[model samples]
Target chain A: MTDVSHRDAGLLRVDTDECKGCGLCIEACPPKVIRMDESLNPYGYRTARYAGAGCTGCGICFLVCPEPGAITVLRAARPRQSTAPGQQARP
Target chain B: MSSEPEVTWEIASSKPASFYSTYERKDELQHATHYCPGCGHGIIHKMLAQAIDELSIQDRTVLISPVGCSVFAYYYFDVGNVQAAHGRAPAVATAVKRSRPGSIVISYQGDGDLSAIGSAEILHAANRGEPITVIFVNNAIYSMTGGQMAPTTLLGQTSTTSPRGRSAAHEGYPLHVSELLATLEAPVYIERVGLGDNKQVAQAARAVRRALENQVRGLGFSLVEILSPCPTIWKMSPVESQRWVRDVMEKTFPLGVLRDHTQAAQSEAVPIPPPPLSMIPGIVGVADAGLPAEMTGDADVPALDLQVRVAGFGGQGVLLLGEVLAEAGLDAGLEVSWLPSYGPEMRSGTSNCHVRLSREPIDSPLVTHPDVLVAMNEPSLRKFCSTVHPGGWILYNGEASPEDCDCRGVHVLARPFTQIANNLGDARAANMVMLGALLEIAGNLPQSSVDSALGRLVRNPKWLALDETALVCGRRLMREARAEVSHAG
Candidate 1:
């Protein structure tokens, strides 16, 4: 069975194999969180990759991506606070 | 190292859902298109496919692909597809949409197909206000046929034909299709868009959708002219091609809605009602005279099937001779067919016609090997003499039969038909003289029928009299030849 790995990260994942390295997305990203990787994908064109952090999940990069399904954005969810037995939970 | 799943939103991709599962041209590359990377066709095709999907007219859609780089469009679009001849997409689309009014017809054309060979087709189709959508892709060069100079080739642009760069004095300026069509009164919507930057691509997508939508709304003709990028032909990288379209092409062709007569077009879209079949005879001025007596079948006439080929130079009335024979055969109650062909030169060009008359239902209108060859000139006689069937007749309009044309099992009557007509007072009656000679020899149709047909065709009494005399002289000549043969035997 194919594994569906779940992760919590406020970041953008580039399907490096599908990218053409047109760099339009790099220009479109307001926070400048995307960059072309030095290593080429299987197709030989240098593909885009997400920087370590600073992604606002604005999705402008996805909006400007000429190739469909090449980039996906995952937003960081609000952290859950652990509630003890005697602790009053804040609304 | 395990973490909770993160919430994410999926943005719509540029590829449309309406694209076929795999391009028919290549089954292995399902995700890949045939177009080169960064080609604007891929983007334009995506925009069109998105529009088709958004409108949900995939079932009712018909895409007409002409001869061009996008000729393979049918392989990608999951809809009814029709491939048209080079520069004939608009004409084929017009017929398709007119016959199937409920369907959505899209004529996709390139600069070469639209502006060059098919200019008249597109212009007339738009002028007629045919309810169809035309997606004109302007790439400034003919990419499909090896980057030849197209009508829309920009000045100073180099191509295979314009290797030294196009000069304004030599190649003229690029054609503004949207502006040209806007000058016409009937077109409902005309817009020019570009597949340049992201913003321009978005606008081009909207324009494509609007043009298709206008057809859906039953509005009149709509065209979306897109300035697309041809990276391979332009010898530029994909990104550079897009940039060139934005920075360079836009300077020549500004993007905007040239005209939008949507509301006015709606009123004109009412389908023209066809006249009743009963009114056809009246419209053609034959209501009083019903189907010719021959067609009504008052037979007892001999079983006759005649095929006649008439050929001559342009001003010689060759087609008229065939028409007269065909008309007389019709009057004689025989099924008749006449087909005429002429060269491009209006005067002094070769002209020819084939006529068939048969008691039985005619098989083919074309007479491949005619039974009777009436050559009104020496060239036609020499050219077609070999094609006549054995034991057939050759009536050449010359002084004497050419040497080496003494083919056995054939009768050749070489006479100066023009001189004979001149003796009869009008050289124009030469065709009539040849017809009379043919009728006298064949006797397939009665002389009275030929006379009546001539009367119907020739309204001028003076020419008719001269033709009648020419016909008699021709009959006499045939009789004299037969008598001389009998005397010699």
Candidate 2:
């Protein structure tokens, strides 16, 4: 819901040490690029991590994050190339 | 270089990033807050932080957190944080706002804190239209104190104290805080919002912002009552708690704007300014009088600073005597204070007052060792005679001073002050008679100031005439007693 969608293209990084695996961020992400990793964080709860290259750089995960500074979304300038081959990716 | 252009966006918290909690947890906790998962306080904190960031008021914002779950709000909100006593946030906030009127003071309180113990403080502060914002969180039960029955606990709701369902006959009805505060005239904005769903949460956010906005605009007394979810105590899942708030809690406390007087209040002119301090003497009817010659702070009379204690039965005008002395001292341009203490009984019970007069500002109103003791009866004389300072004077209203009482270095002026007042046809004027004798014995005032003070105090013309005659008789009796002592010597 924040203005991070202005660029329409970005990457995400979640701090494994700070994420409680609350999954609120996962529920909020429109692209579903965020997922709780199988590997346990230092405190033992599964930490959230970027799943694939489909991240739209939308900061919904950051806004819904209870832990401040846990999620960082870096947005890119132009339209991103899709991981899929041959088929035209819809915007 | 055949690549997509760089968007260049970084989601580092928010700009009031300073407003968010980047706390380094001692225990390495993952969450920014200590509140349990799905607690509405976390959401409310987020909304408030966003509002503060948007308004750019983080520097001037002062959050007063009282006891209960939000007691550790200082750790979350990175503003001027103040921890108030369990139920005294409104009072503390009042002083803070009044002293630093530029600052935005917010009193954050819970149901148990605001409704039960702090009811009077909030009511009076809101009634006075103090320019402060209050964020009241009603979670139905006392969550912090192990989920006890709160004033806002709904009927049929069970808490630790209300083991069974809350009964109307025994427990009474729930207190609608938003409705109660809305009844007050001073509050410019009042709303009750819930955090049940996204729609409700959005409405709550707006209410919080509007409440703070009213404060920013110098509007008086705004409060936003947030019906938050206490999932841990409610023994429900976080999602279930949300449903409970929406389906169940909303029935008891409906979500809506209860009142909004902001536009009307802002257009109205400010109230009249307070009168100047120089006008007080005139207002109290003491400006026209000429102070006695001896009271002009002369070197010959010596600076008179008297701490006098008057003690007697409740109905004997003991406090009245102290008041007259204090008023006369003020009329003579001296610093004065009068403090009274009495038992519960209205009459015949013990009563006392301490009166202090000083050329300089008085330090304290209490007189543990009085320079003068005016004992209205034999029991009062015996009780207080020992505490008189050495070389102090005691004016006792008896046939004769108690011979066995150890007055030591204290001088005694035992006389029938009441009998003299009775002779003047009013026994109640005895206190005025005693005042006359005390002033004459102290040899400070010219009796005119005392008369003016009596004129200011008493309203009836006939009683005022009788009191004037009584003062003359008291001064004459003091003169006669001095003469008798000199003759014997």
Candidate 3:
């Protein structure tokens, strides 16, 4: 099994200013790595929050979230060690 | 939080570059959209923007936004935007794509817009096989105008209009748009996708992208129908509304590709570019007849404003007189407007026309108070003589001006113009005689402009010669009348 504790796969950031606290991302997240904040933002709705770990960055949350800039997903770069003999790393 | 080594991160998905960084639709909500929480338009807009960004066509993309909650789409998209009237997006998109083949035109419409009022526009555009992409968002209800039943509203669904839930016997069955469009032969791609779940959303994004790609390849008539959720209108939580779209809406409108002729379809022929603006007059056979050099430039001309109203019986060329005056004004590089009002009967029915010519732009074609009035008969004289402005001129086609008629401070040129024209060989040329008197009074339109306008309008050479003689006789009579008035004074 893959190591779930390692933070190597992906990271998620939620722009609270733009999020409407729809919770669509929380429900659609495959790893269940997103949650609703305990307190509401200035718009008076509890916004989505990234759970500190276990994000695979499949971008399902980004696709399902209605807000354009609310959810942004970042995937970890592939390790150089996995490259073949003479294959240069992509910029 | 121990790690062997830190891994670098790259952005996988964010806001598309095609979207404006800040929506200027409203003052307060610059960073957010006008859509309600969990509205499908936001997601759909993102998908469309992403497609435009990927194809690198943002510069040439022209989005025809329909009348709906998305009418303000221009405020968000950083591309060419046109807001079409309710349901006319397809018609507007066809015109845009045909006129500008280089543009990537998209018609974004909702269920009520596409299927209800704009049914004919969408049908004919698709029948013609226009090369454009259409994004049809079906929420089964008119969410923007409150929860009202739409053409695509499913049976047993309650709305403001269908309070008892739609009954098949009463409201009829829901429209299956994708299936209906797939029956047509011209469409190259037609698909129905939803935003009910993660998988569905992924498919919808791919479908949206593919529709745009098909348009880029010159394939004809691609549409993607999205089964979206209206959480506010449905009175359900955002997540519950999403579930309803998957469970209930999907049963009525199945999710899948209904038509896919993209592989077999050939690219459409390149549209012929329209002729240059300067060549249009030549192509229409109006070139080089005798358009003056002044017609091309108005800067050197003196300021002039003339308003004339001509009224007579239907057969009396009253409208033709007005047309000649306006056409002469145009040939003299003046702004002109001609508006004709007449009765139904063509021969003896009363007819009148208003003409305005000015060095500056004419505001309106309507002339309520004219500076000059050409009354061809006693009835026309009595009807319009009072409406003439003070210090204006009145040309009455009679042997003598009526004593009861008010001609105070207004110059009156009363003559038997019809008798003069009859002597000149054609009584029908009376209108031209009155026009000649009018030109003498105005003194702005050159004789050359008037002659060319007459030559272009009057085809038969026999009548043309009679009209020319009548015009010269009318001018001589006007000069004599003015000289007699000066002597009497």
lDDT of 1 at A32: 69
lDDT of 1 by residue, B397-451 (tens): 9998789775467778889999889888988899988988888776757888889
Ranking by lDDT: 3, 1, 2
Which ten residues in a row are the worst by lDDT in model 3 chain B?
Answer: B341-350
Q: What DockQ do you compute for every candidate structure?
A: 0.07, 0.13, 0.43
Instruction: Write down the RMSD of candidate 3 (Cα, Å).
Output: 19.5
By TM-score, is 1 or 2 better?
1
The candidate that wins on lDDT is 3
Which candidate do you rate higher for TM-score, 2 or 3? Answer: 3
The candidate scoring highest on TM-score is 3
| Model 2: per-residue Cα lDDT over B129-164, one tens digit each | 888899998899988767889989999999999999
Pull out the clashing pairs in model 2.
A76-B6, A76-B7, A77-B5, A77-B6, A77-B7, A78-B5
Off by over 4 Å in 3: A1-6, A80-91, B1-3, B276-489
Per-candidate interface C-alpha RMSD? 4.8, 4.3, 1.6
Q: Give the DockQ-based CAPRI class for model 3.
A: acceptable
| DockQ comparison, 2 vs 3, better candidate | 3
